[model samples]
Target: MISGVLISTLKAQQASVLQLRNWRTLNLRRTVVSPRIAHLRHRHLRQKSIPVAANIISEFRKANVRCTPSGEKIFKQAYAKAPANTFSCSWELYSPLWTTIRGEDTPDSLCYRNLNVSSARQWRSRQAYDICISFKVYKVWEALYTNSNIFRQLIDDQEKDCRDFSRCCMALQPLWLWLKLVVKEGLVERGDVDQLPEPSMLRDVVIGSGDPPDAVDLGLVNPAMCH
Candidate 1:
């Protein structure tokens, strides 16, 4: 009887040890696999969204510029004497305005170099006036989306939130700026701007719905959210 009781006790201890070992192995697997699964999920979503985003951008590029209410107001104010039925500004003229705005001198150089008309007759020319008004209106629109403070915060947060995704965010910045410009200019609807996919973690911050206090202060939030 003593030998049998000893054998039974030994078997019970062995079973407890095995159970503990199995639990630890299961936990270890979970620890290792969880992050990998998360990373793969992120990559999958990004891949799926890319082609859709590219198509949207391609369509936006092909679409002609149509002034929003704000853009129309800008146009009328800039060309009060011109006929109401004036045609949309040609892309040839509009394209150079972006280059000028991105330049170091910016509005100063834009004003003095392109818009400095020596006479009222020079100002009266539609081509010259188009350049001036387009620059002025776009400059204002650029500030709305590219607030220096908000952009700096975006970079900082991108590094903190996900270092791996930072490079992707940097690459997308120019495209984002272009999208914002078209939206503000009334060339594209705010709904269209919302279709561009961003990383799940950074989407709120980029679109101005995140915890960044500066976004609200600077009015850097995407206009779509307000509606």
Candidate 2:
């Protein structure tokens, strides 16, 4: 009876050892496999996102727009007056510039055509307004583009705020449209587009003061507002 009991005890200890070894093997496999799976998932996501970002950037480069010398000067002056933390030009800066550009003594509201004044007096043509706003938009973009560090920061901020790279790219659409309008209005010559800042230098800017909650809309140059 004693011999049998001792044998039984020895078998039980051996079984426990085997069970522990099997458990360790299983745990070790999980530890190794989980991270490999995670790495592959991360790489797959990165691969998927790269093309979308590349396409957006490629499309943006196709705008082929540049700021006029006068526009560049104006942007420089405005940038100088802006706060150090200012990432984009504001309407406060643009408004005064517009007034100066218009050379009008009229109230700001009237100058912007916000008032429903009598039609008896001649007003600026819609095309004229379009050109003016488009010029301003082009200059703002040029200013940002020339300052590559700020431009990249602006894009990075937009990406963080939206948490979507595509949406960050979309924020640039209004600027692109306004740029195309600048080209359409003959403000920028086709030859000048070739001289635009490098594609890597491109970035987005708000046409007005304060950062919006999401993407930067058309601001003063909204199509509906233009019409």
RMSD to true structure for each model, in Å: 17.8, 15.4
Error of 2 at 101 (Å): 5.2
Sequence-dependent TM-score of model 1: 0.24
* Candidate 1: regions farther than 4 A off: 49-227
lDDT of 2 by residue, 1-227 (tens): 57988999999999999999999999999998999999999998775554322322233344444444444443344344444434353323334344444452322122335435336524468777555445544554554455444344554444454444443433244334434333433333335554655433554444454334332332333333333
The TM-score between candidate 2 and the true structure equals 0.27
Tell me how far the alpha carbon of residue 171 in candidate 2 is from the true structure, in angstroms, after superposition.
5.0
TM-score of every prediction relative to native: 0.24, 0.27
Reference-based lDDT, each prediction: 0.41, 0.46
Quick one: best TM-score, which candidate? 2
Q: In candidate 1, what are the lDDT values of residues 51-157, reduced to their tens digit? A: 32233333333332233444333333333433322212222223432443344232212232354523432554665754544443333233323433332343344
| Whole-structure CA lDDT of model 2 | 0.46
Lowest summed lDDT window (length 10), candidate 1? 84-93
C-alpha displacement of 117 in model 1, angstroms? 28
